[model samples]
Target: MLALDFINIGNGDCILIREMEGTRQKFALMVDFGHDCLVRDDHPGELDPRSQRIYAGDFLRELGVTHLDVALATHFHRDHIGGLGRVLDAVTIDRFYTTYLPPENAPELDPFHPDNNLPKAARSALLCLQIFTEALQSHPGRIKQFELVPGTETISLQLTPDLKMDILCGEPALYRRQKEIYDAAFNGERNGYELVRWAKSMNVCSLRQRLYYHGKEIVLGGDAYAHVWETVNLTPCDILKVPHHASFDSTS
Candidate 1:
């Protein structure tokens, strides 16, 4: 049996996929479990912040899922990875997937990194990266395997003779191009004052994936926005998990 649960983790995403074998073996994969109060600030009637995390944790436990075959972090944004640290602490993940990996020379202590000359936004991003790296260091055996995938890459899992899951996406060429331009401008000191604006614009670099199961296809369109989609190749799918929680600016 194959099942997919679109976990309610507030404005973020926490999708759980299950593949059952015969009667004893089972496999599970999780894609982005995050929660942020700001995303729900406009909806005062939504679930309480504390309850949201608790509920998500309880759901996983109820499923008898002690370990995950794969756990993916689409991006480093707080809203997309906020409560994930807690989840990681609670569960055993065999394989991990993410867009960025800690640098070989990652500092042992928190310090200004990835170029102090960069704007505050970029600096903050580097800090987040540092934190994730530290977490992996703290738990050496927790993650048996780790894969740093980019836009065009794909990860395939064979569940049964008939059911399969394919994680697919196009390469992130446009984002890299934009970064080159940003770097040139910043290096030339031509737009030093607009550093934050240019740095913040990199948020659309989120990863997108297409999950194929049986004969149906579902697209997990991370937080990728309109401009990001324009640079990638996306085919039609049976189901589409609306991008950026269906934010107006996320899609055309």
Candidate 2:
């Protein structure tokens, strides 16, 4: 049986997927871990009292899951990967996947930088990437493998005899284009407003994933925007994790 747990993490996303044989979990995968605040006791968001909120790591421990077969971070948004540091502290991941892997020579855009006047969205993205990078570095030995989901082709993996997963979207070209704009702005060649505009529209580069269990199909749309769907091939699915929290710009 295939079990999917969509954990309640306020405004973020945390999904756990497991394939079970009777009561034993044969395989396990996690998509995102939600924001860091959700794992903290002093979370400021007014959550529904009846709905219990738990950190991704705690939730895994409660379910007796110690090692994840695979973990995918669809994008660098805080709402999707902020709590990953906490999760890494609690569980061992066998393989880690992401849409973009920062180049080793990437510029340092920290607060101390002379031209660190990035807009809110750009700053937030940088922070999220920094946190994720730190988390991975902290547990280098724990995670056995790391890979980047390719933008040019779909990667199909056979999870089990009856289960499979397809990495459907990853646009390194789009990411590079935006990075160039970001770099120009940081170097004073372009205005900060241009970087802000690009940041707001960067959701188009988020990854889109699809899973097949038996004959049923489930689509995990990450934060992809409407225009992204127009370019990719998406089939009918039994369940769809609506993109961008089902915002006005989510659907095609």
Candidate 3:
């Protein structure tokens, strides 16, 4: 059986997936954590600042996971990847997965639109993440990064013989055209982390995943823009984590 847990991490979502059983095999995959940047909560009660925010060390200890074979950061947004830094601090990761990064100061404005009309809040978040990415690149022991070419790789969990996972996104490209733009901005430093020039712009969130093997599938859709999700080939799973805080018109 698959031991899956999807906690309502405030506006953002956090998913925990585990499989296998006894006999020297066990594993758990924790998805994103809650974000403090939300308007309301379904639960009507007092607010707790300490609640929902999944700091890396605390989250791992809470789940009793000192390390993870796989850590997937679907995209580079605070809500989706906000807790990644902290999580890395607590757990040793075997593999890290993420989509492409835009330029540092060079942003490809929404061409179709006249001014790339973006909300003030989103713009602020993107700026924060840029700094975060810089840090990610500088971290002494950041988890190794990998390109998840669809139909080229699979994510499986073998605790022993109870659960497994399979996932694919960008099989297809979330933003194929933007790749060139993001590439141009890279200066290729020794740190080797992808860098982007910041000109002030953003797009739909980008994140996708499905866990299964012994009868369980958890789908995590990060804030992939329409360009990303619309083209990607995705098979719906038992548990579907919505993208962009269930936003009305981010990525459907």
Candidate 1, which segments miss by more than 4 Å at Cα? Answer: 21-25, 36-56, 108-124, 150-160, 170-202, 230-233
Worst 10 residues of 3 by lDDT: 189-198
lDDT rank, highest first?
2, 1, 3
TM-score of 3: 0.62
Query: Model 2 — TM-score against the truth?
Result: 0.85
1-252: candidate 1 lDDT, tens digit per residue: 667788766667778877777654377878877663434634667554476344345567776667888888877665666656556666788888876565444455332543446656655544444456566666667778888675555667664565566655444673454445444433333333444554465456666667667788878888878776777576789988888888899899
Report the C-alpha lDDT of model 2 over 1-252, residue by residue, as the tens digit.
999999877668899999998989999999988887754434665656687888788888889898999999877777888889888878888888876655444444462345666666666655666666667666667778888665667889897888899987656687566566645533445355765666675677777789999899999989998888887666789999999899998996
Model 1 whole-model lDDT (C-alpha atoms): 0.64
Greater lDDT among 2 and 3 belongs to 2
Higher-TM-score candidate among 1 and 2? 2
- Which of candidates 1 and 3 reaches a greater TM-score? 1
In candidate 2, which residue pairs clash?
none
User: In model 3, where do residues sit more than 4 Å from their true spots?
Assistant: 20-25, 33-56, 101-128, 142-145, 148-164, 170-174, 181-205, 224-236, 250-252
Q: Which ten residues in a row have the lowest lDDT in candidate 1?
A: 184-193
Global lDDT of model 3: 0.52
What is the Å distance of residue 188 in model 1 from its true position?
21
After aligning candidate 3 to the native by TM-score, how far in Å is the CA of 99 from where it should be?
1.3
For each candidate, C-alpha RMSD in Å? 5.4, 3.6, 7.7
Local accuracy by lDDT, each model = 0.64, 0.77, 0.52
TM-score of each: 0.72, 0.85, 0.62
